[model samples]
Target: MSAPVRADALATLTAWRPADPGQRALREAFLGFLAARPDSCARSCEPGHLTASALVLDATGDQVLLTLHPRVGAWLQLGGHCESTDATLAGAALREATEESGIEGLTIDPVPLHVDVHPITCSLGVPTRHFDVRFLVRAPAGARETRSEESLDLRWWPLDAPPDHELDDLLAAAQIAR
Candidate 1:
């Protein structure tokens, strides 16, 4: 995107300090990535790029919406890489959540709830790391979700009992946000 957008993302990351030791390490690593690469926020930064994800909770706060990601073949949060139009990392998370969930008027907590860096083999057979900045977003009550092409299925699961994999970070974010 524009220089200012990337700068804003960097500023957001710079301002955050996670309580969890492991998460703090990831955040520090993310700051290093930004310092090393000016284009780190761009999807075209093949070495590794930035992504934004949302741990979305329904209005009642007891349930979470998850997407069974087609490529990853796992139930995961609503999120994707940054776009040219995304002004901030939090905005990117909200856009991805709304687009994937098909729910309107979703509100996001401006501050990030978690940060993670993970490796993935892209569709183009390129290895990349996703420096995912995770935000807590809320969907309106009774909002219906439509399945997007990116997901095998879209469903809401109880926060008290989430899917077996990748629940820890999501649960932690939910708890902290509340």
Candidate 2:
């Protein structure tokens, strides 16, 4: 709802460089969306909105913290809509990871690991595309987590094996980033 987050989202997308042509294309589209819509980061924005999320890894980087998102009915990483208090897209990613994981001492790579666009029904009660910027977060060694209401269940899985097959490429990118 504030200008800072929207500004940050614009700058973040502008400055990002990805090796993949596909990601590059998405990044360009996201930049265009941000430039045209002042409310790009807000839930009120129609058709599409920017969401930040993180692929959480343990200190050893061998395990990943995943949540059973009730709305999506799938095991996914921690992250959500950018809040009014967020000053940057990276901070919003960190906030979502911490809130959904209930774990402290989590460190994040400020640069995005990946960006995705997926159609879903969100709080707006209509179909929209989530322009998700994904980052990598590392939890403290053997860090304990408390389940937040946002998840149907939260747990850590071996990095090599996740409940979602779609995460394979994203997780690989995260591993390289970390």
Candidate 3:
């Protein structure tokens, strides 16, 4: 990623103060990650890397778009690892949302909606942690979604009552976004 993109991510994280103890710990950890590696956001970063993701809401904000991730086999919001072309974490989230959702003109809330650190076994058999910075993205009215190759299926789900076990963080992020 470019210097400006790195700077943007740093700036955003620096300004964020999480409301809860768990989130506060995540913020500190993310800051540490940024300090430890300038290319922390890059997918190639060994051991762990940063990722950008979104809780994508429909135009009315009553529904959310989710993808059944092929690898994880779970319904998740659109997102992925940062790309060299991304100029900001928000940009990365937006790009991932647009690409995965196959929808254009999606508007993203600049402030981060959530932060999480999770372990994953990559395709190459390497274990890594994804320090995910999450944002809230709003889709345009009458938007139609197409499934990307990364997903087994893509669908819109009611925001008021999401699947309890699978989307606890997403539901919490929705509350934070609102």
lDDT by residue for model 3 (110-137), tens: 8888898889875536888898899999
lDDT of each: 0.86, 0.91, 0.86
Name the weakest run of 10 consecutive residues (lDDT summed) in model 3.
162-171
Better of 1 and 3 by TM-score: 1
The root-mean-square deviation over C-alpha atoms between each candidate and the true structure, in angstroms, is: 1.2, 0.9, 1.4
| Model 2 score (lDDT) | 0.91
Minimal lDDT window, size 10, model 1 = 164-173
Give per-residue CA lDDT, model 1, range 117-148, as digits (tens): 88887553788888888899998878899988
Rank list by TM-score:
2, 1, 3
lDDT of 3 at 98: 94
The residue-by-residue lDDT of candidate 2 on 1-178, one tens digit each, is 9799888888888889999999999999999988888888998898799999999999999899999989999988899998999999999999999998889999998888999999999899899999999999999987998899999999999888898797887888877776
Query: In terms of lDDT, which candidate is stronger, 2 or 3?
Result: 2
